[model samples]
Target chain A: MKHTISVLVENHSGVLSRITGLFSRRGFNIESLAVGPTQDPEVSRITIIADGDEHTVEQIEKQLNKLIEVIKVRTLTKDECFARELMLVKVSCPAEKRSEIMTIAEMTEAKIVDVTLTTVTLEICARYQKLERFIEIVAPYGITELVRTGTIAIQKGSETMDRKK
Target chain B: MKMKACQAMVECLKAENIKVVFGYPGAAICPFYDALMDSGIKHVLVRHEANAGHEASGMARMTGKPAVCVVTSGPGAVNLITAIATAYADSIPIVCITGQVNTDQIGSDVFQEADITGAAEPFVKHSYLVKDPNDIPRVFKEAFYIAGSGRPGPVLIDMPMDVQKAEIDFEYPKKADIRSYKPTLKGNAFQVKRVMAELEKAKKPLICIGGGVFAANAQDEVVKLSHTMNIPVITTMMGISVFSDDDPLFFGMLGSHGVPAANRAVNECDVLFLVGARVGDRAVRTPLALEQTTKILHIDIDPAELGKNIRVDFPLVGDAKNVLTQLLERAKPMQHDEWLAQLESWRVERKFATAKKGTVVPRQFIDKLSRRLPDNTVVVADVGQNQIWTATSFHIGEGGRFMTSGGMGTMGYSLPAAIGAKIADPKRPVIAICGDGSLQMCMMELATAVQNDVRVKLVVMTNKRLGMVRELQTKGYNGRETAVFLDGSPDFIKLAEAYGIRSCRVTDDRSADEAISLLAEYDGIALVEVIVDENEATL
Candidate 1:
């Protein structure tokens, strides 16, 4: 099962490797990880969704805490968090089929970022599943290139990651 | 309380950040293994002393730290020579601790007595023979530092049986001050400038790389040089993935078994600028014959490499990366159209790979296996054809790494070292590449991998013969295969199964595909055995 986790860490070299390393070393599949700077320049937040049993997650949290760079880590389950994923996918499109591709993009509320001689780039933002589904349906159009910003999570209630237990 | 040499060794190990060691217990080395009890420095007993030494090399490669291998003196120490030489060649930081003959019997040639210090000197960076127990602490500290620092290579500490038998008011020295041993970190300014001036004047320049590029963490600098100069870069097998192929200037690896473009470029280029590498037989198989009038500038930290093969016009005996940075200041911006064009013309779909003539091509299997793993996975390749294939076909990502016995070319390296790498970062995927012959030399370490819960996927290119020798016979000799194999080989999957590790076998492309799928999906230590025909060329 995929469990979202918010990990706060010191901005240090090799810290990201250490975080991902814990899951990999433990033989857990880390679904996705999105790391970015918070308001504090010294601290960065790593939002990770990893597949593991509760004990494995508990171990992961403990391992993260053990790293000198890690400040804190907390499980941000789907029920307690609101999340979105962003992706930019370039699909092969014939000149005549451009309008048909644009129409599909419009219905999904995704914008067409670029149109080249042979490809059309679509900008998407939604739940991970929604984006995946959109891409799956459009894959027959031929995915030439893809870039996804993994997934980022924030608590649904007024509580921020730092404010939550 | 009188501390045994074993206890003293443990104390030194803890101070050196050594989390684990691989070894076997003998009459002399048994006490040290016993001392490991209650000691946090985990001691893994291998099936043989040679494997212990090889494992230490793997550990060092995996963790970027010095690794220890302990064994009894005499035959045991002799066993470690091949392993030590491999570390020496690859420049992996390994500190070997061997049980020696009692101090009283120095030259008596008693049973299990050998001049281990004298034996190891030619191969090791530094060899220390300790007679007194008091020197243990200082020697241990120095051994660790020397093994890991500067050019990273193996160092030996042979403790007398009496010394391990004696006690020490052990005082672990934190610093080492050796007058003769200070490594040159900064390049000579004048030489650097001279190089820079030449680089500018030459329209066609190519950078021939060695293992030293990665050793100095000069990947960025190398990338900078190639980008700024628009110079094509070719590497020794050891220098393989230090830079990415996506980098346009990457001419691919050079030497006898190198990419045709790289070799052809070496022949075609007017200026061959060697950086931080030894122009070995592998790098410059046809050093004598040049397609064009080539001028070579050998830049290496070790002075011996300057005139060793091809006489160096500019023999700057300094660190390759350090000197290259200095040369960057003076290197010109001239480009050669004809040279670049001719070099490009030499390319024939430019793949650095070969196949087994008699049976399955190992490169195809290894490349397929490598593709299944994540781009950032680490492959610890043993010496021989396995290392060659790994260097050629395993496309490393930004963090994907390849570690092997480059200098000594030690066979039994994969399994144990992967354990250390796995320990270094348990979450990152670590795989070991070995041949069937090499795998037998260190197969006992499967126990170590399982015991530590350090799972490193073991991928063996099992050809059931000494593939390197086989290659040599074909390439160098008249296809005369010698003492290369025994009739029956042990069932590796069953062997791994015995150790409670999952395993898969790949005989054909179909089994290869299925095997790759399973190996990638499995979490713990999995053995993927690929059967290649006996007639394979390493290059």
Candidate 2:
């Protein structure tokens, strides 16, 4: 099972390394992780997606919370949270195939950020499955390069991870 | 007043009430040492950088406070890694300060430059690499606070040479308040009530303690709880000194190499009150299986330790002293007469096989020595077969201490540790028992002992083998023992004498008795080399 772990940490130098170091040290594998500043400048939020059983996930959550810089940790499953990932893809394209790729991008709500004579670069921000499907349809166009900000999530409804447990 | 960053650092140490520091000097650390010269804080020069750390650990364990160790950059700091890791593993609080190359020299591969904070990241509770001189006082305060606080462990501070030379306003923080680092000290009222309810219902309940009990200085509170509720108590290896061997309510140490009664109590107990123990694999090999039959109520300072090892039915996160004190307040007398009797019945005296002629049996020797020592004696046991023998045989009565590198199981630990403990309290007798293999690892510490005039007793159990590994090879590897021999070992008695310390060699139990008396009665440092049968069992 896949679980999303959201952690609030002090926005200090090496805090990111400390969180990532903990995951590797405890033998927990991270499938995807996204970290950025929160509403409070003093604090940063890190979202980690990992695959583990219920017990393993619980252990991971506890271990993450053990880091001195870590302020709070909450683990949620995909069904309970709204998760999204951002991807930028640069695909090989001639003038003939450009319109065809644009239609596929239009269907997925992806934006064409750059247009070159032989390559078209597009940016897409969507759920993990939607991004994967978009990649599947555009793969035959000879994709040249791809980059992604791995999965980040927030619980659905009025629940905020910012509140103290 | 404005002063060098190094002066501010020394001032910080004085503010922490640190009267002594164990360290080895180098060019990078010279500025701090120079500032320390007039600060009235004593510095003991150790032979190796690592022993400085170990010695500080000894002081910390004895005083129940964070002790300090300092070393130079590069090799000096790198050498102290084992000691740092050792202290971290055992939850012994120590602040390790290392000098670094100039700020600009870092990452340039300049001479004597090491990223100590990066290297010690995983082992330390927290660490700092000071780039600005102004952060000196604050960093030192935070380092000490983090090191000595809840679930105590080692913390590191790496100061660059240029930064130490820069001037900074001297103002040490009166109190360290890290917003993210506040530890839970008191247990929840509802959880305490639940624990009480469980205790009321448990027929074959047992209390298991660990190193965290010592970390919290909660030995007395735990003892009170055990007595108040009439529960039998067992301890993990690190929890050795919490209960005396003669305590009627006390069972022996529990683990793979644990006392039969203690192991059986763990199996039979309906509710196991795990106080300050993580229940490592060595303590309970099959935690899941044990969890099926036993309802474990674990109270620890670190919440991460709650369900990390075994399943906990009642998890209480707080300091051991506070939680146990909470339990003591409303606790009433309860009966486990039948259960106690069952445990007592299973507690059989272990019989030792006869030793070869002209050789001493370790267990018998330890028992005799323990009896002869003073009540306040501190026994520092090094790793390997010697540790097992001492842990099983040493009688730590009231006021006595049992110190070891239990969690990390580091060899060559006892000598420096004994020196540290003796230095911490000169009146308390300190003895270090180590095997020849382990002794050779840090025998250079003899110079440290003699130079400092720290009169610590050394007991070398010379079995001419890495006895623990040899035993493992015998049992598990079809008796194929390779690279287990200590063929080129030196004469430890002569070695001690060369260092200008009194020394003796004992081959049998009779000679061991006289040597023990000499060790205990000697006004100065002494070394007793006890020759043991190579095939003697660890148990």
Winning model by lDDT: 2
Off by over 4 Å in 2: A76-81, A155-159
Q: Which lDDT tens digits does candidate 1 get at residues A1-165?
A: 778888888775456766675566557788889999999998899998888877667667755654445777789877888889999999999999899999999899999999998999999999888998998878999998999998998888788766744
Error of 1 at B104 (Å): 1.9
Q: What is the TM-score of chain A alone in each candidate?
A: 0.93, 0.95
Quote the lDDT for B72 in model 2: 100
Extract clashing residue pairs from model 2. none
lDDT for B465 (candidate 2): 99
What is each predicted model's overall lDDT from 0 to 1? 0.77, 0.92
Report the poorest 10 consecutive residues by lDDT, candidate 1 chain B.
Answer: B350-359
Please give the lDDT score at residue B349 for candidate 1. 69
Scored against the true structure, residue B220 in model 2 reaches a CA lDDT of: 96
| Cα lDDT of model 2 by residue, B221-301, tens digit | 999999999999999999998998888999999998888999999999999999999998889999989999999999999
Instruction: Flag regions of model 1 displaced more than 4 Å.
Output: A1-165, B1-6, B290-292, B327-342, B350-360, B471-482, B534-539
Model 2 gets an lDDT of 0.92
Clashes of each: 9, 0
